[model samples]
Target chain A: MIKVQQEDFDVSAELAALAAGNHGIGGIVSFVGLVRDLVGPDNAEPALRAMTLEHYPAMTEKKLGDIEAQANARWPLEASLIIHRYGRLEPGAQIVLVACAAAHRQDAFDSCNFLMDWLKTEAPFWKLEETEAGEDWVDSRASDDAAAARWQAKPDRAAE
Target chain B: MKILYFAWLRQRIGVAAEEFDLPADVTTIDDLVGYLTAKGPGYAKGFAEPQVIRAAVNYEYVPFDHKLSNNDEVAFFPPVTGG
Candidate 1:
């Protein structure tokens, strides 16, 4: 499942829903992203503040679907879910959530990390952090692409 | 044609989205970028560092050689930085 919405979600409820299925799955891995109080590129702002998120409508869902499909292909996942929020948010507010279930801990952990890595690089979302200095849109970081590439490089090398 | 920009590219270009007519010979991402750079100073400035810009055709990440058609929606963004 993939979602992009303005409303906040219940983390416990989501985890329960994902875990309530058939008992074939033995492990579940989940991740939650939260808005930080400090602003600026590196959280260098003196006064902590809020954030606003923006995203493309059709593109966001399509990209997420692709990422989920990739994860399912790599692992025998019983279930998976990705939820990301849009609109204005404050410090400590949840920004995104990713959950994965598989037969082993390794698959679950890897898939959870993979989902986040791809989402960070490919998802069509932008953040505008407001601080004492004013509002500043965040810049793209090379680290995200590196994270995504780590998994992809193995296959690429094999093909080469 | 619909065009989208993200991350620092959006900030530098000063707009999130724009609509423009597809040029006749712009059959690839590289061609499209060249055409856009000629349109105005803002686009030229935004696309100045061509090597750093990443593109997607209809939400699928594409290389410069990727083919494009009039119906396609193209987006340009910088290297992603999310956790």
Candidate 2:
């Protein structure tokens, strides 16, 4: 499942839904993102008042589907879910959730990590931090690009 | 053609999306950036740093060298910052 919504979600309910009846899944790994009250490098600058997520409606969904497809192509996944929230949200509010289920812990763990890494660089969603100093669009980090780049070598190494 | 902007580009361009009558000379995403830069400083500023800017055609990521069609849906945005 891939969702881009303004409303908050129930993580437990969503995870359970992912693993509903199929007993073949041995494990599930998940990651949830949250808005922070402090923003910037080292998360030490600007006190965040709120966060507003902006995204291209149709394009966001299309890109997410592509990301999910890539994960499935790379791993033996039983199920996966990605939920990203938009609109105004307070600090500490849930912003995104990613869960992956597979027949083993390694696949579930690695695929879950790969899903988040790709989403960080490929997803169309953008974060606008509203702080007492004023609102600013969050800048992209090189660290994220590097994180996603690691997977580029994985397929080649696996084949070798 | 429908052209869209997001993140800081949208903020600087002062519009989320717009219909544009693309010129024949503007054949690719790179050319389109030049055309938009000529619109005004707001657009110029938005596209000033070509390296950090990203483009999509019909909702798929593409290079600046990717060719454009008159009816294509084009979008320019900054590097994504979402997780």
Candidate 3:
């Protein structure tokens, strides 16, 4: 499942739903990304007051669905979920969530990481960080591109 | 054809969306971008750095050489920063 919403979500509730009736699922891995207070040069001080997220309505959902589909094809997962929030969010607010359930721990863990790595680089959302200094559009990090690239170095499903 | 701009591009272009008849010569995304940049100051400024500007056709990301159709929805924006 994949969702893009303006409202916050309950992480625990989402996890419960993913593993609801899946008795075959023996392990689950999840990741939550939060809006941090730190910003500016060194990212050592608390400068960000809020972050306004913008996305193309239908396009956002389409891209997220594609990412989820790719993850499912690459892993032996019983279930997976992705929830991302938009609009003006304050510091420490939940920004995104990824959860995966599988019969083994490896698939759950690896797929969770894969989902997040692709989401960071491929999702069609933009962020404007509001701070005392001024609002600034966040830039795509090279590190993120690097992380996403590793997955492409090999075929879709290769035994690790 | 429909053209959409987002985030800073929308702010700079002063409009979110617009419709135009695709000229016969505008066969690809790069061609369409060149046409937009030649339209007016707003477009020129918004696409000042065309290399950094990204595009999508029918809601899917595409390369500059991606072919264009008469009724396609094309969007222009900066690199994605979402998680």
Q: What is the TM-score, restricted to chain A, for candidate 3?
A: 0.93
Residue pairs with colliding backbones in model 3 are: none
Worst 10 residues of 2 chain A by lDDT: A151-160
Writing each residue's lDDT as its tens digit, candidate 3 over A82-142 gives 9999999999999999999999898899899999999988888999999888888998899
* After superposition, candidate 3 runs with Cα above 4 Å error: A39-46, A155-157
Q: How accurate is candidate 3 locally (lDDT)?
A: 0.91
Best by lDDT: 3
Please give, as one word, the docking class of candidate 1: acceptable
lDDT of 1 by residue, A11-114 (tens): 99998888895698898899999987764677565564788887766878898899999999887789999999988898899999999998888889988998
What overall lDDT, based on C-alpha atoms, would model 1 receive against the true structure?
0.84
Alpha-carbon lDDT, every model: 0.84, 0.90, 0.91
TM-score of each: 0.86, 0.95, 0.95
Residues B1-83, model 1: lDDT tens digits: 88998766777778888888788888899998899888778888999999988898887889999988888889997765443
Candidate 3 CAPRI grade? high
The residue ranges of model 1 lying beyond 4 angstroms of the native Cα positions read A39-44, A154-160, B11-15
